[model samples]
Target: MPSGSVALSARPEIIGGPPPGAATLEARDACAWFGDRLVLEGVDLVMPKGKVTALIGPSGCGKSTFLRLLNRMHELIPGAALDGEILLDGNDIYAVGTRAQQVRMRIGMVFQKPNPFPAMSIRENVLAGLKLARLKCDDKDTLVEQSLLRAGLWKEVRDRLDSPGGALSGGQQQRLCIARSLAVYPNVLLMDEPCSALDPTSTRRVEETIDELRGEVTVVIVTHNMQQAHRVSDLCAFFLAEENQPGFVVEQGDTLEMFSSPRDPRTLDYVEGRFG
Candidate 1:
């Protein structure tokens, strides 16, 4: 562990320098609409399995919308419709008879807010994903420890696994949510502004967890914080949506290179803080 970094060695299975997942993801000419309003269009992206990809842009640019589209989450909205195909390892996730629940099982999600089930204990929260998937683990205690360790929360709450998840501080609750997401062993994790509500220390811990998850799980994140994007991502895509125009990919590439030398003026401006 580096100086100032929290120790996260309790679960050595997820020490990620390179991704170690089984499938890759690609979106070809993807488009989305909320009833009669078009929010995103002509979107294409490829996120390699076991790597971290960051989606950064101004608010309302469809970053979160695109993240939700990956697992058919948008279908939950009435009158919501989409165009194009999102593929997981060359297989269309939207193919007929494919269950949305199954797709979500393989690609888990962590939202911006720390939304631990209020009535559940920390241990229960950590194992929530498995329950949602209707899977049972024989070694429940071990699973909780490993998941919390992977989320960088094991040491603090190891002795109080039965405490209500909502009783935790905002940061701890967020990490608990992360632990819950990891418990299911999803191949890809989708995060929408995961650190938006945390303090600096909490944000750093979450970032470390994301770093460690590399090679163990593919992570796609939407963020307004460019610094966070540059730190945790292997690759990045800049999205833009202007008045009367649907959101589209402005540019994308290696994170370091994209920040240091962007191909488009808008990319350079956004990265340099000239404009969002």
Candidate 2:
């Protein structure tokens, strides 16, 4: 097994049929670049199964880049390249014969912005992933309801299933995106500042959804919001890059410990509003 990779164990039952089973994601000696410029280097971290891990750092520290690497999204950028292994359940996702599409299916992503197909109805938006992945569901109605319920948006939009997804409020749209991701039943969910674009109420709702999904999906979120990170995450990793240097992990541990008793001065400074 790669360093930081944990053995899989039996998963508890979840709402959407037999659990897809949460997975431990491990990055080993991970380095990323855009063309010839090294942006992130030597990052090794373990995202434990069925827990929320927050990547908290200042802007331009490569937190988003690192999150993209886990699901093979990094390769989508022109001139983007990465070194080292990203392990899912101890298997290398970047290994030969491993298809990018398959990796993405197992590891779904929710972006910084809510991106629902504006023309698609709410029901269609939720089932979009299944259609794109060629996954068949015996009962689409039940799946939609279950997904929306899990995302904490079912009651609000239950009667408006036929409404255009874009017609919903910003927070509702974001939760709809979460429902879409959940419909595919991914083992690991990657969120990039999921609540950054929402109002406070919407942010709270999204955070509530994140808390509810804990222990059912392994979640890795990148956030500049320290308070949100502390509230929603079980583990935290702090990344830092000095002047003209490649970004790297400065500290990582339990969320409470990282906030209350961080060993590194940089972490303390960043967390206490001293500096990024």
Candidate 3:
């Protein structure tokens, strides 16, 4: 929304204000802790209206934690507490008026492992979110069709919507999860290591889906695969942690610059494979 100022070079320009009707979500000096252990401290970032921002770091670096915080999922964990603000469309999600269910509806998530509801059919899984949201009225078929198509899974499973979601292949299942997230039509989609368990071919398909889904929803992914980050993200944020320390953001910039001309030496080392 701000002009003439660039945050991450690889990040697409914000253009004008909130993409002509897009919601504005931002995290300002946000901090999270589980009991006495801090995970993220004073983390500040923005999820541009309809762009993908990838969070990358080695294991235990809090990338997943950050993802959870975006949608208030962190608070669901026992003993977890949060401070500061997570603003959705300029309203703090932590505000009393903001309920957890409401926050999740606006910021849907996909997991590292495909956890399709085993009891639910493909069609049921896709509509699960809306069902929870209590959304009603016309065009149920149209919404399901568009959601599946948008997830790039329609042609493969169009005629078998009644089949169990677990009956799908690993890749199809992941796409099914994507469709599930899309059903709610969230303003942002958080994916945590979404392709980690898939094969190369499956990863490619999911990445392609991500590329296609851009401008339709804001996406934030946490991944250990640097190449995947480069291939799929518009912006990149690097995280790190040391002994006795919680993970913190080391550097964040455009994927191109972070991979090529990183401003931090640690980022350069990690990207160059000198360190994890």
- The candidate scoring highest on TM-score is 2
Can you write out model 3's per-residue Cα lDDT over 1-276, one digit (the tens) per residue?
222111221222222112222355688987789999887887788778778899988788888988899899998899998888888878888888777887887788999999988789999998887777776525567667767876778889889899999989998999899988876667788999999999998899888888877766789999888899999998998988877788888888789999999999999998888877
- Model 3: runs farther than 4 Å from truth? 1-22
Once superposed on the true structure, which residue ranges of model 2 sit more than 4 Å away at CA?
A: 1-19
User: How close is every model to the real structure, measured as TM-score?
Assistant: 0.92, 0.93, 0.90
Q: Tens digits of per-residue lDDT for model 1 on 146-225? A: 78887889999999999999999999999999889877667789999999999999999999999888877789999999
How does model 3 score by TM-score?
Answer: 0.90
Clashes of each: 4, 0, 1
TM-score for model 2? Answer: 0.93
Cα lDDT for residue 148, model 1? 85
Count backbone clashes in candidate 2: 0
Provide the overall lDDT of each model, using Cα atoms, as 2-decimal numbers: 0.86, 0.90, 0.81
For model 2, state the Cα shift of residue 276 in Å: 1.8
